[model samples]
Target: MAYLDPRPANPAEALTELLAGNERFVNGTRVHPHQDAEHRAAVATAQRPFAVVFGCSDSRLAAEIIFDRGLGDLFVVRTAGHIVGVEVTASLEYGVTVLGAPLVVVLGHDSCGAIQATHAAMTGTRLPGRELGAIAERVTPSIWQANARQITDYDEVGMIHVRRTVENLTRPGTELGDAVAAGRCDVVGMFYRLADGRVSVLAAESAGE
Candidate 1:
């Protein structure tokens, strides 16, 4: 079967499509023609992705593969810890405003190194360089909150970060916020388990207009 644009009118439907696709991926029965040359050429003319995914830059967690989506099917923005930086925000803006994507998923994963490093920093463990420090700094607030709750596991910490990041995207003046408020987009958070290949959605509320 060809890769279909499953951009549903209801935000909940969009979420369902993503979850269903992930189920297909976990079962090893992904749909076809997503990466083919013919499909690539067809998408070269114009693209109409159904959803925008903001995920971590972890090699083990590929948004397309995890969602069982093909090229041009997802407008993906990836960064360390799935941080919502200016550039990442801009990319999501383009995806939502320009590409007309109806769903935005902030995808974090289990055992994320970024979350671990942030936890270490928050716990007074020295980080090596400024580069790593930057990542730690971005994630420190979530780490501190998780630490306050006595959550030590990397998976728990990562989930905290995912929820915080999704909250950040929903804040006013953000592209995600605007799109969501206008009832044109939905912002959701999810966690991908590397071991079991399951994606757990953290939030289900629609970005109400």
Candidate 2:
């Protein structure tokens, strides 16, 4: 593994690498790659992470541990609900355009408190603070979509949120979208299972698309 290549040739390769790592984690066979003293020194001068992980701030959703990835493997950004704001977009753009990351992964998980809170807010429970309400507000669309589809499952709402975030990031006018258009990157949305520690793809778009 070229642990220091920020650009991994193509999106498929980068996505595959992440999924493989998740598989390792699922099977309890993680090799803990790129975390040793030597690899640490190798990335000390310059870092070249291959994927940018935009995920929720849920404690159990720790990107590196959940994906079985090590240092210099993933550039990660997190928010309460993985809500995409201006700063999120800018950070992801820097990862793709400046760091040359080939893949962006939006990871949502089952039993997400954010999703539950958003659902509660939709069903008449008020959120406490303006800031937290804002986070819940951002996640409300997914809950609404789920309700429109007659799906009341919290995990499914989380998946919808993941898909929406990926869509928003890769939409026509965004920098991430431009990178995808230019064959420089791709975006994938996935759901993490809290009970089993596995990941499943919910939405994806490649440069080929």
- Local distance difference test, per candidate? 0.83, 0.86
Candidate achieving the largest TM-score: 2
> By summed lDDT, which 10 consecutive residues of candidate 2 come out lowest?
1-10
The sequence of per-residue lDDT tens digits that candidate 1 reaches over residues 46-107 is 78888889999999888888888787888988998887678888899898889888898999
- Indicate the residue-level lDDT of 41 in model 1: 74
Candidate 2 residue-wise lDDT at 93: 93
Clashes of each: 0, 0
Which residues of candidate 2, in runs, are more than 4 Å off? 1-7, 204-209
User: Which residue pairs does candidate 1 place in steric collision?
Assistant: none
* Per-residue lDDT of model 2, residues 1-209, tens digit only: 34553446678999998999999999999999888888888788777888999999999999999889888888999998899899999999998899888999999998999888877777777654776888887998888777887888888778878988988898898899888899899988989999999999884434442
lDDT of candidate 2? Answer: 0.86
Candidate 1's displacement at residue 67, Å, is 0.9
